[model samples]
Target: MPLGTVLVTGGASGLGAAVVDAVAREGGRPVILDRFPTGSGHDEVCVDLVDARAAEEAVREVSQRVGGLDAVVTCAGTDSCGQFGDVGGEDWDRVVKVNLLGTAAVVRAALPDLEARHGRVVTVASTLGLRVLSDATAYCASKFGVIGFSRALAVETQGRIGVTTLVPGGMHTAFFDGRDEQYKPGPDAKLNQPQDVARAVIFALQQPPGCEVRELVITPSVEGSWP
Candidate 1:
């Protein structure tokens, strides 16, 4: 079943973009709330995820434009890769603000519309959220926060709406493009394609009511991140 009026953050690129394409392929409506426009023939609101208030307002605006929201995928994320003390304070804070706080803000504003429409939310966390790594304090912290937030939100929302936390391993995306060589995946390292992972998201979104996909972990067969 196609998700109606789904809003996706960071839907302009990477996994979020893949999910957008998947939703369209499945004949679902995908609206984008991102800092850039997602040219997928869907409505898009250009808003910075790092600003909680702006993120919330963008979500509300999209809900209003679409008439209602049936689902939301919080996929906008940032990272500051360096030893804790080496990373700048502002950069590290932005990672947390965008990945965790922004996710919360979007969902926070969308909840009323979601509850009324019985919508679902899929939050994109990382395998690092489960297993800690060095030189990634900010990313790890934000993702870990996402894990906790998603769990708590599921309980708080209860029957009003559904929430799923997607714990994905390393993927071949531009997420690592500008990172230092040390932060990049090795040549032989296995990583899932964003499109492949997008299928998992589609599956979660298409499940029947009362059968919620509360949590999901998608990783490559040889991915070393997950133990």
Candidate 2:
């Protein structure tokens, strides 16, 4: 089947923006949902995914504006790093709310439209979800929750809708703006480009109805190890 309309959360920048561009390049109508303007020609829904009511309203408004919904890509996520015992309660809560609960809220809002169209859902998780990282307890926990949630959702949907979890290693994006300098990936490290992960999302969306690419883990070949 030809690619149709796609809705991308966090589409203002990073992997989400790349996914929006990829979808547009492939002749799909792409709609962006984010807190800021991307300045792209595609429709935009400005909302904070962590705000449940706003997220739901934005999804409904986008679905109506687009006439129908065909695909959803949940790319809105954030990470925080701290030793389990050192991280404050508020910090942990904020990370989990944005990375885990926020994603679930977006999916809950979009599931009806996805089921109605038998559309695909591509969620951008992290390689950390599959492996543990020291000092990143909250981030790892949130991503692991995402992976589990996607698996359960896939089972519940049971072929009525396609669900995919995109687990990618260190990307060349500004996800670590305020992190301690030592924690950042080495400059020599060949981090995956945002576009690389976006391409994976496109690939998942292009699958046939009878097929589902349940999970994909992508790491840079130069990394030489699983992230």
Query: Best candidate per lDDT, number?
Result: 1
Residue pairs clashing, model 1: none
Candidate 2 on 1-227: residue-level lDDT in tens?
66688989989888898999999999999999898887887898898776877888888888888887899898888776778898898888878887888888878888888899899888878888888878888888999999999999999997799999999988888777778887777779789889988988999999987999999998898784384
Can you list the residue pairs that collide in candidate 2? Answer: none
Error of 2 at 1 (Å): 3.1
- TM-scores, all candidates, are 0.98, 0.95
For model 2, state the Cα shift of residue 95 in Å: 1.4
Task: For candidate 1, write residues 46-93 as lDDT tens digits.
Answer: 999888998888888888888988999988888989999999999999
Candidate 2 matches the true fold with a TM-score of: 0.95
Q: Please tell me which predicted candidate would have the highest TM-score against the true structure.
A: 1
Off by over 4 Å in 2: 224-227
